[model samples]
Target chain A: MSQAAAAPLPPSHREPRTERGRRTHRAILDAAAHEFGTRGYHDTGITHITARAGVALGSFYTWFESKEAVFRALVADLSAQVRDHVGPHVAAAPDGLAAEEAGLAHFLAFARQQKLIYRIIDEAEFVAPDAFRAHYETTAARILTRLQAAAAKGEIRADVSEAHAWAIMGMNVFLGLRYGIWDDSAATTAVAQTANSMLRDGLKP
Target chain B: MSQAAAAPLPPSHREPRTERGRRTHRAILDAAAHEFGTRGYHDTGITHITARAGVALGSFYTWFESKEAVFRALVADLSAQVRDHVGPHVAAAPDGLAAEEAGLAHFLAFARQQKLIYRIIDEAEFVAPDAFRAHYETTAARILTRLQAAAAKGEIRADVSEAHAWAIMGMNVFLGLRYGIWDDSAATTAVAQTANSMLRDGLKP
Candidate 1:
């Protein structure tokens, strides 16, 4: 526990101008993700993140005012990572259904490599409630937008709503947890294909 | 804050035989749920639980050896609570898809009352790793069994698999978090109904 944990962090951290400074910022955020993901938010400290990133204490303060600020940034960064990783696959799909399957497949693959995403995002519910809510809310909103677009394009059901978006998001998240984080014995594509079928035809006999 | 946080607890707690003992045990557990749910496992103390239950220190130790024991028990208890609450509704539904709808509706309703359930169960991942894994594994297993039975009965798609069960479970959970815990502006029936429509017929246009 550092003094940083006790104080309120600034709304945002300093934006690094130089390439070297940007790399240091990225390194700190990456290390914070691992530290917070593995040890949890409360148990992780500023010093630990600095040590993990191989950066000095003063350098940390230059980018992040406190542990909380870095954590907030990490949540945003991870959320972006999921989007950036899945977005291309989704964009390449020919239809809404294929887009969803591609999204799930890419997400599961991403989850396998970054198992800490679940932990850090979940812990944000306790440590950073706003960030936690924003992450899911933003994600759900994006799903809703896509579903509506697909509906307009006649690529999906006409009755797509926020509830449907939440449902699909939930399905993807839980599947990722079970297959992606808990165990990877099952093929990622197989799992995605199974869930995608349900998303396509549902459980109708 | 107590030594109990660091010390290893006995594997299991003593079972109460007498009626009075059972009553006391139940009270302690209820109090423990509130304390752990509100304050978190690491921050919560046995004294807080005892104080909340209005039971003496000795009474707390009578049924549970340490804070860890009670936390583990609470995890199991909450898991059972979800099952017990959702089971009757699921059983009463006329068909497999209807059963899932009923189950999700009931779960959302249950989550509204037991809002802290997500916090406590999720925190178990860090505080009690085995308990956390067991909670989800058991839930997913039960879901798979039901889905398989429905498939055999020709109620749902014949190709239903464990992946389908996990997907459905995930949908119910995220929907619960959003509609159940985050906000109650939307009707539970409406939320469940919308998601159920997707389960009955997916997003195909």
Candidate 2:
């Protein structure tokens, strides 16, 4: 998760005042994820989102000001969703290495279910650069914290640092892309176990 | 390092038959790298590439059919460039693990010098999907070959598999983005050494 707590809608986004409004807000964001993920930022429009959301044009404006605003929000939403979905699995693990394995396995499962995730997040690089950077930065920071805590308890090496966190994040991200998004032939647990062993024992003969 | 040998220009591309033509072809590709790298595929034009290359309008057509064609070719060209540039350094290392270290170190330097590389390659995911997939698939395949060879020699664990190769590639790629593209403050060798150490000894206390 990001160092910042899960924030409510930012200033640019108008916070829904009632349960109905909140449902509308959530609907639009989910619809935006599908439209943007399928049609891409350039091809997707506010009407596309509104149409898919089954919300009135006025409702989209009630929450988001523009196509860019919604896209940015969706990126953050997806980032948070990944963290929330995988955080529990990671916390349930027996140790640091097992936590990583669980995190990766859960992530792969999430990616498989939400295939549009890769497209939307990848598109953020061009559509919203700050969100893209923040997503990775915060994700790496969270991983760093976990590794440091693990090291402190002697669960892993004492020299764990930010680079190691980034390395692990990289591993999980690519593995998710290959085994989760591209092809589902490989078993998620099997993949996670293979990667976990490498982390646990290195490659030394 | 693709399983297939570095190929001559595919049929879509007109291979220059003479030295002067070859120079023109090379110039056009380098110019495409800069133009597409900067302006991106949608914003860049054939005229822009030709203008940057300082080649005649006819010469652009002689080498490439359209902007999309050139972008596809550029992805392949950059892929080959990375393989060729990093291959020698990897080969010069004494063993499998050290070779990965050298490969990463050299890649960081290369990414620093060619900062446009990340932008172009990332954009290819949307602009030219096949080429983008080919770049990574071939790269992972090459890594798998190295790991299998190392395992056979008793330099690394015999259980090394395709998953291990993807994990390593992911590590190098993300590390390169963080230390190489995002910030230059970190020492490349130090970062590579840190990551290499994890691969060498795992994270056990």
Candidate 3:
């Protein structure tokens, strides 16, 4: 561990001014995703990230002050990545429930391709506790917003609240872990449809 | 880090034979839970565990061989603790959905009291991957069996499968994190009842 890593610093203290600087910053983050995703936080080093990014040590310092900063940034980046990847698919759905199904299906697909997303995000609970909480809080809040919109449109129950959003988010997260990360043998659409059915119609006999 | 911790040993390779021995073993595990739960795995040492347990160095070795062994055992122990804590509440419910409601309510209470549980279990993902997997796998399997039983009893849809089980487990987990670990301001029974309503009836208005 580097001495710089010991002192906590703001993750995004510096931003790229030009295209070349932006490219270098992006490369460093992408490389960080791979290294932190694979080697984990304790084992991974700034040199490992720089080596993988093919950037100079000075370039890393210019962008990120320490290992912790890059990791915190990566957590936020991955959180945004999930939102970007699934947002459009969700928006395309005709109704709120359908939007959920679509969001889950796309999330499963994203998890399969970007398997490291789970590891990176999960580790944030310890490495960057605030970021971890923010990710779920943001995701659940988004779900709540969608649910409220659906309720206003008379598409779903009028009593939709924060708890409902949390429940749905939890269901989607675990389903992604089981079908997406643990095994890809199961069809994503089929899994989504099954869960969506339960969401669409109660599990009554 | 001790050299003994480097070698992988069966978590339960040595079992206490006498009453006195069993008490000593239990004390060590309880102490380990506190140390590992608070300090985390890498930061904790054997002496830390022994001192906390009020046992001598030899007493620590009498039951477990290394730090890794105790940590693995702790994962399994915590997993069992959750099951033992929540099982009766679930079983005592009159119906399938009600059982889920009861399970969540009790689980929330358990999380609030044993706050260290989330940290220890979450850390197991990196420290003891297999044990972490086993914990969820076993919990999901139990949920599946309950769903199947409920289906047979005409309490739920006939098609309740592993997917449904995973979805419910996910809901409970995230709900626990939000309402249980993060903030206990919300009444657990209220959260469980709201979630149960969704499971009992579809989200449709």
Please report the candidate that would top DockQ against the real structure.
2
Candidate models: Cα lDDT each: 0.88, 0.89, 0.89
Where does model 3 exceed 4 Å of error? A1-11, B1-11
lDDT of 2 at A101: 91
Which CAPRI level is candidate 1?
medium
Candidate 2 lDDT over B60-99, as tens digits, reads 9998898889998899889899999999999888999998
What is the docking quality class of candidate 2? Answer: medium
Candidate 3 collision pairs: none
Worst ten-residue run, lDDT, model 2 chain B?
B1-10
Which of 1 and 3 is the better model by DockQ?
A: 1
Clashes of 1: 0
Tens digits of per-residue lDDT for model 3 on B1-205? 1223323435553888999998988999999999999999999999999999999999988888889889888877777888999999989999988888899999999999989999998998899887777778878888999999999999999999889999999999999999998888899999999998998897999
Candidate RMSDs in Å, in order, are: 5.7, 2.8, 5.6
Instruction: Give the candidates in order of DockQ, highest first.
Output: 2, 1, 3
